[model samples]
Target chain A: MLLGAWGIALFLAGWEVVGQTGALGMSCPPLSAVLAVLADPARALLFQRALGATLGAVATGYGLGLVFGVVAAAAGHLLPGMRGGLDRTSSVIHAIPSVALAPLLILSLGRQATPAALAGINTYFILYVATSSGLAGTSPVLRDLMSVLGAGRWMRFVRIDLPAALPTLVSGMRMAAPGALIGAIIGEWFGASRGVGVIILNAMQNFQIPLLWSMVLLTVMISLTLFWLLGAMQLGAARRYR
Target chain B: MPTAVRVAGVSKRFRLDGGADFLALDRVSVSIGAGEFVALLGPSGCGKSTLLRLVAALEEPSEGQVTVAGSAPGELARAHRLGVAFQDHALLPWLDVTANIGLPFRVAGRAVDRARVSALIGLVGLAGFEAAKPRQLSGGMRQRVAIARALVLRPDVLLLDEPFGALDAVTRRQMNIELQRIWSEQGTTTLLVTHDVREALFLADRIVVLSPRPGRVARELVVPFARPRDAAVMRTEAFHRLADELTDALGGGA
Candidate 1:
């Protein structure tokens, strides 16, 4: 935890130093200017709204990814051929950039919720692959143990397979959570009236260095909170396994 | 006594590369009576474990059939009549020792009898360690938990495949004693496959010896020693004679 705080401190220091030095072509505001903009009531309301939109998108996408991934993975076991096919398809989907797919999603679903939903769709494949692989990795001996003991399909899944695969699932969620945030931000960047991504894009276009930095800081704080929540879940799941 | 399990011309063959077949067990036949403790003893690669798996109905026999309690082994297993403990304890690492012991009950959709679970825990000498996970327990303790799990359902037929092969010598001896006590109390028909000749002779009423490759029973020795036997019996002349006899029969230096 201390190391993580130190890393964030170092990052902010570097950004402040670079901005104050005027290394870039335009005027680059320091940390104080970013703090001043954050303190302003009008800018603070904008920050709140944009941050809310981005976080909402991320949450929606991540939740859907988790549900779909588990269902697909469970279905995969019953149909071996389907498992292979779905695995290949998910890999293909993962290879496509979320930024690249954003425009297409907007074209089809048109603005509200769809772009966010698209971002959520982007997170699904990673979760699915992680969960399916973890479930498949259950040892043959363990499977036989359940079988010989008269554990039917559902019982084996709930008692044995699910618990065994939880650590891997948690790890996948950690990976997917960050990806979900990135996807939502990227989706908003393409076309959104309000969001942290839109604010950053507008600030860049208008050369408002202080507002851009403040938005960037707010995005970082939100991401950190989401990641911390995932970490807590991981630690809780790990304790059970231990 | 009624035949608890019958293997009539049971044969198992695996398909090899280039469409060839590798015969593990060739038309092997054996009959075990109810409440009998039998051991299938053989050297490594003698299909002893394979035969045990067949009896447990984990795998279907390519030819012939296996019956447990007058029904198909697979059917009986599906009906919750078969219990198995592999060489590896095969306990779910995620579950606590008590939950591991109560697995059969949980699988059968029955509320775990906490009293019975505690008694089995005591029976296997793991009374206070109920909350421990499999990884935290020693190798012997894991096997004891496995034994408790097998007997949890009060199974009619228990199939064990070298259940203590992973343990050290001292732990193996202790487990053998514990196994005898459990078997006596439970009165479940047990088929144990082990490389340890002394273990087979110590626990089993009859020991069926098998030869290497294309496994078949070469000899069946009826143990003459009385029940309630202990490790002290291993020092007896009769026990040594049986051990030496089995060793010689397996082509090992005696």
Candidate 2:
């Protein structure tokens, strides 16, 4: 609660300073003006629609990435030779900037949520590497113990490997959450009819500084909420393990 | 006497990358009788552990056959006839004490018997810690949990690879007593690999001493102590005599 209050205070203070100083060619809008726009129910509906669209794309992409990442990591152990090739390909994908690839994804998927999905493509690789390394990191002592106890391969994986890999997987998911949202917004910026990205683009084209600032605040709120949700999930899983 | 296990001309060779094959165990032969507690005493790298693994079916002998209960060790393991514990408490950290102890039964697709689990927990003196995770327990307690887990299925034969090797001296002594008590109660044929001569003497019905490098049996000493042996047995002349005999058999270096 204290952190939330500090965040609101800092944002308002920054808004006031930028508005008063008129720096950065600023016709900076005050916090009250943004809140007033938010209070307008009809305008609020537009923001809500944009928020919904962005969230939908992010959610879909993140879900797909998470499922595929875990499966790939588990399969990597069953097929050792494939691990190096898959890891190299994932690193290459990670190296490509998501923003630069947004246009290509849009072209391929015909300007739908494909670009956002592309933004989340790297998320799985991060999670896969983390999970696989975590699984591989089972101590030799522990491995010998299990083997001596007559635990089969499946038993070892279920009993030892999965629990050990969970923390890494959760951290990877937390890291990927923001990336998913950013990918969605970048997709919208490149080619989309709706979303905060589209709103910010329009505001810039018309030189509507106050509206652009409002849209930026909305994006920050959305991203923060998504990140907090993922963090909560991580905490819950950790608690369960404890 | 029915032999519970027979390791005839058993040898194990491990090949390193771009290196010559390293012989872990030479052509070794030993037979353990039913319901006997035999300790494999050797120095580090003597392949005592390798021999134990062969008995447990965790590894196959490179040159010879290892049979447990008249069948291959692997078959005995699959039939839930072999149980093992290691020096490291291999309890699943995610599982609580009870769940870990129940694992063998669970693996065999048998329903967990709460009464049996409670009995085993009581046998290990871990009565109130059923819900505690392995990470939450101390090293000794975690090892007790591992021992309980190994015994949960009530296997005919038990294999231990220095199961108390990681504990402090005092705790190791206490655990030795606990192990003897448990073994007497269970009456399962048992094989233990340990570097500690006192521990082997304290717990084993017979001690098998192995020489260093390409491990082979050097001596076999039968322990004539009575059941329910306590830490006080360590202070007896007979105990010291046996320890000296085993120590000399270990070539005064181990």
Highest-lDDT candidate = 1
Instruction: Evaluate candidate 1 and give its CAPRI docking class based on DockQ.
Output: medium
- TM for candidate 1 is 0.94
Output candidate 2 Cα RMSD.
Answer: 3.0
Candidate 2 residue pairs in clash (backbone atoms < 3 Å): none
Error of 1 at B68 (Å): 1.6
Count of backbone clashes, every candidate in sequence: 1, 0
Candidate with best DockQ: 1
Model 2 CA deviation exceeding 4 Å by range? A1-15, A27-42, A81-85, A88-96, A99-104, A145-151, A239-242, B15-21, B228-232
What tens-digit string does per-residue lDDT give for candidate 1 at A160-231?
A: 777888888887887787678778877787778788888889989998878888888777777778788889
User: Native contacts retained by model 1, as a fraction?
Assistant: 0.77
Query: DockQ of each candidate's interface versus the true one?
Result: 0.70, 0.40
Instruction: Estimate the Cα RMSD of every predicted model relative to the unseen true structure.
Output: 2.3, 3.0
lDDT of 2 by residue, A1-242 (tens): 99999998997889777766667455676777766666678787898888788878787888888888888888786578888887887788778888777777877776777645764686676777877887787777666656655667887787677777787778788888877777777788876878777888898899887778788888788778877887998887676654
Pick the TM-score winner: 1
